[model samples]
Target: MNYKDLEFSTYPGFDEYILVKNLVDTPVKYKRGASYETIYNNEFNKWQDFFCQQYQVPAGKDVLLLHCCSWAKPYDFSIIINPIKQIADKYKNVHRVIMSNVGVVPYEFQMNETFCGYDFMNVDNEEKNVQEINHLYAKSLEERLFQYLESHIDRYKQVVLYSRPINMGNAPAVKNACERAGIPLIIEPNIDIYVKYRQKKYKQLDELFIEKECLDSLDKTLQLVGEKVGS
Candidate 1:
């Protein structure tokens, strides 16, 4: 996929260019709710075997995994990392961890150098232009993510997704990807809990009310996805 040939609202950045590359590298047909039971089962075992062989790790070693969007806010950072931290501390031989996001890298994982080069929030342009750029960036992320999961579904031992349920950000794209790959997606329920906790602690109705809107947005998203698949 020559990204230059495609039209984007704004000029493509380094991160967007990489996403295009990844998308082109892994091509797969995506259909919502596609049955992949047999393929997924077979690939899951194969991936484990392949990784063990390649890395010379014991086949029995467990792999713990978690993921968050690159553009997640500070609050979301806490939500996603806390659980992973607890589990990693408790376990041994848990070698592989994966975080998927476009741009911003998690501070804890900065040494891993897995984050993209651009910052999604720092697009300096007119408000309307910025919105368009963000939309294009998100679309690129979604398409690249779908291709990535299709190619590497078996590589994951567990997939935990942390995102605001309302925003299409990475959750819907990841959900669709997992469904197509016949993988079970573990969604952290921390977002709702976090919002409620804040509301109670701060006693700020107006601010909390805005945060609580995510719950409704989440429901609407689920309904929309359900309707799409059902149709």
Candidate 2:
């Protein structure tokens, strides 16, 4: 199916439909031999340098690293990170770290003070919508997170990771990092229950199937990670 042959309609009042043929006509050019390790190492070095320049930290400070996954909407951030935040709040020495490809947190969520530090890694913007062009995007994201953890594994007293197990590309990376660091990793937290709760409470069923699929994928990812960790 040629995506260039599609037309997208505007709002209710607008009668004209925009032709996206020109936009879709140009194919995305992918980099050659792009792998998770390569991308992660590059990003890790860059971010590590940035962190060193931006913040001055004492040698022995403990960091409670909260690794967040890629989330499109503000509600997803709230739903996923809130429980993790509750857990992090228990420790006084834990320095909260939240990293994202884009530094966008919705005003309604009010998570400005929630994190002690932020790592703005613009990896997603480099990715193209075309699967063939950006097949390594998900893996790159997971590797980047793993790389961040690996870099700081020795610097902190204890490292705790809270991320949804939705991407297959980087699940192995996460498991490897956890094993190397000897840290406890928290994967999927009854997202099915969360989905049902959201459905009943908000009555937003428009994207229900999509949400369920994502949650189901996360659950599978969690299982895979558990198996790998145990092995």
Candidate 3:
């Protein structure tokens, strides 16, 4: 299948649908080569510099940066995995950090991994770790957010942050930061197919439950109770 041939017009729908449907719509293929690493490293360096400059992070301050633990496999194999180290080394002001990545396990398990510092937020990855990371990402986000809020007001105030290739929902965590502080939240690849799938799936489940519980219950009652009364 030509995965690229999916009806998605690149409008950035949820990635879950895109990935689930990708196999059906197009063949899953990843390009491999040494040059892939070189190109990825270059891009990684550029993004690090961009985040540093964009935030005007002064030298020698603890930075609170959030980055995705996943990216294109090529990039992941090369540079996407080491953003915290990269920024910490590049900028002297980056003394401290708060970060997360998608999980490959359930949320409960992912939470422990996150607190232990595994920061793998690519929840969509077929890997158990990645899914586990994602499963616990939101809860972890809430935990980390509150921790940062509680301990380091000054540090959280000056955090030079970045999150991409992962989705943070439209919840109070994001909204509070936006409203309270002008911490600009940037979401790269604005597509949200996963969210759409979640919504659609919920609706289907609701309908099925109603059919099974209400409709089936009434039918069963009529068959059993009605027959008894008539007899």
Candidate 4:
């Protein structure tokens, strides 16, 4: 079925309630009352794998990593677009990647029903126990993330997880993968600013990148890419 053909849902908990069953041709059945956050990813059954395969890095483009957000379209969020806009358009030759819980997603595929349709993005509380980091859930995601970075590291001219620099706000999985892969990661945002707004105004993972320093670093990185690409 076409993504455009899926009916719009105004579910109370999500921006849209697009059943994973409807998104793909393969049949899927979730357990009774399975929340998107706690749903077991039936990867071998072709559920999560299909979306993971959608990720791609364009030729000669740098890759920028961002965590998945509540909205179906990640770029629709201002924190994402604001920083992107500050960069040079020529150097803006970038592959915006969303480090989603189920899998990695390319920005171009954000509109794909497989990506934009579902609702499972509460990363800080991802583990079975919020205090425990050794759980299977977090381990699975980190394994996949490391594999993603390892496999795709050579594709882009540069891979950067350029986000708001916070002491702990950024995704450690991405940071560790980049570190393991030796990819350049520009993370030095204003923690004081992030802390100031994080408690009262921020409720989502993506919102943590809403810092001025992030925008400036991204602008410089893109400008440098532009210079390197001779655009």
Model 1 lDDT per residue over 169-216, tens place? 555665676676666665543565545545355432213323444334
Clashes of 4: 1
Candidate 4: tens digits of C-alpha lDDT, residues 39-143: 345532243444334334566665554544445344444555545533533454665565544455555544444444455434445556443422443455556
Top lDDT hit = 4
Residue-level lDDT for 69 in candidate 1: 33
Candidate 2 runs further than 4 Å off? 1-48, 52-63, 69-87, 102-135, 166-172, 180-184, 188-231
TM-scores of all predicted structures: 0.43, 0.39, 0.32, 0.61
**Whose TM-score is higher: candidate 1's or candidate 2's?**
1
C-alpha RMSD for every candidate: 15.4, 16.0, 21.6, 7.4
Using TM-score as the measure, which candidate wins? 4
Clashes of each: 0, 0, 39, 1
- For model 2, name the residue pairs that clash: none
Query: lDDT: which is higher, 2 or 4?
Result: 4
TM-score of 1: 0.43
Shift in Å, residue 216, candidate 3: 59
Give the local distance difference test score of model 2.
0.39
Q: What is the C-alpha local distance difference test score of each model? A: 0.38, 0.39, 0.32, 0.49
Minimum summed lDDT over a 10-residue window in model 2 is located at: 103-112
Compared with the true structure, the alpha-carbon lDDT of candidate 1 equals: 0.38
Candidate 2 C-alpha lDDT tens digits along 22-140: 22233323222334443444323433333433223334346544445333232224555544444443444444455443221211222222222222233464545334324454544
